[model samples]
Target: LNFQLLRVMEEWQQQLGEQHYVAMANDLLMNLDLPGQVSSLTDIGPELLVQLFEAICCDCRVGMIRPAVTQADLRHNLACVIDSLANDVLHVSLSHIRPADLMSGNYEAIRNLLEIFHGLMEFLVGRSAGGDGGDVTAETQLEENENLNGRLTDQLDRIAGQAAEINELAKRLAELRQADRPLPQTPLPATAAAAAVDAEAAPNGDTSDEGIVQ
Candidate 1:
């Protein structure tokens, strides 16, 4: 971390405050693909990246995004931010942020955030789907997201595997058909020996093998 980024982050921390991190996180989360999410308000510097992340999460937390916001709905949003940072945000290129890096950074904090989202999401899913189980509501979001994400992931894998199998079977069928069909047969021409024998045996034929000899 450079002094420039440090100063920028400090400024953001002061300006946005920790209470508003969720909203900040939310905005940054949505605008990963946009060019001027927060770099417009905050000065452009090395910590520019950190500033953006903080602005996103924190801004979304307490700022203007509340009415339509939910802490439990942020993984995909976070993933989107992470993807933008790793991929490039708003046409602003980032060196290379591995998704694993996001996973490892502040796992506890991230987990806590995810847990909040998970609970919130579960509530929404159940409420929307009309499922009932009062005790299951606490960590319902995490359980649901994990299960659904896993099932969808598995379904994709199965579909890919099936396509490969069908392709292989089609290739084999073509080969078997080529091998099973009978090959063309060429007829042998009549031999000279049979003609000679028939001439020799004729009642008026030349004696011995002289006639056939020529």
Candidate 2:
């Protein structure tokens, strides 16, 4: 299966140009964290097979390959890859793969599935290179651009929402600070008892002792 996958990739390199092939390969290996030099797909371990398939599925989903590739097609191809890896390479049971009952162990089935995958790859690469009577039409390119624009618009909307939330939080914080400020202190009026004492001491508008008995 690895050999087959490698052959498909090499064909892609030849047909799609080294730059395009390298870009696809790098995308697959982006976060795999594989050790040493991985000069080919065969260098990838059985455990990482799912990741490789997932990357390819993503490419298909995003219209990176051919617009004709549908979700069902991706699903089928993915099942094929998983089936081949689980049964042949890893020698594991189908339960290990999601939708365990997807495919049963059979040499014939495996071969057929691999051939299908190869054909699918060929179709993808051929379409990308404007061959196989399936050149990327203007409509497909427009659809891809619209999809990309939609993603960018969603991101921008999310960013704008976050920015608005931050601004609102900042405004609330400033209002809280204003509300927490200490108010200026005001002098209190004199007590009633103190006022009475002053009035008594100044009786008849005089503070002198002229009316006091000797």
Candidate 3:
């Protein structure tokens, strides 16, 4: 198990970059009294196993290793890690592997545990990175949608105001046209028309009579 863990650490260092790996190792060493090298799987203790599990499963920094993995993939890989250790090394069925059982000072128990941890670390890294990116993207898209909706609402208001003004102008123009139209003339009575004709001819008839008398 120590040999497997060493290999896993070496591969992780290569993937994570030497500088970053060194920094992470320094931090882990500060918290725990772990040796610089692993002599045997029997030398590993429960504390180290717990620390390793926390580092790989719960630490945020592990995400830097892979950034594109999805949640489903992470879950699947974690399940496989547990199943592999349970079936091959422990020869038992396990829904989840406890840190205590990982390094109980027993060679068989510790065997392949670190290997499973290594695999689980890869998936954890992907999950962390992908979750952060997904959150940021979702927030950005939401903000953009809000901005677009605001713009659409403003345009609709402007169009509505313009339409209202057009309607009012049409109404006023109709009123003005109605005011300019000629009033209808009523027809005179037949008796009134005859009286008006005689009045107009009376002066002409009197002048003719005066001419004849002279």
Q: Write the per-residue lDDT of candidate 2 for residues 77-195, one digit (tens) a residue.
A: 54666555444432333332332222333222222222323333444454457555666679986775455445434534543464465455556555645676432232333454455
List residue ranges in candidate 3 displaced over 4 A.
1-35, 59-104, 127-132, 136-214
Comparing 1 with 2 on TM-score, the higher-scoring candidate is: 2
Ten-residue region with minimum lDDT total, candidate 2: 105-114
* lDDT for each candidate structure: 0.41, 0.43, 0.45
- Give lDDT tens digits, candidate 3, residues 1-214: 2333444544553344334334444444443444564444444555455456545545222222132165444434444445543454333444334433543444334433443454344444444565655445777656644554454345345434644654555565556456664322426755567766666667754643322212
lDDT of 2 at 90: 29
Report residue 118 deviation for candidate 1 (angstroms).
Answer: 22
User: Order of candidates by TM-score, top first?
Assistant: 3, 2, 1
Clash counts for the predictions, in order? 22, 0, 0
Q: Report the backbone clash tally of model 3.
A: 0
Candidate 1 TM-score over all chains jointly: 0.24
Q: Better model by lDDT, 2 or 3? A: 3
lDDT ranking, best first: 3, 2, 1
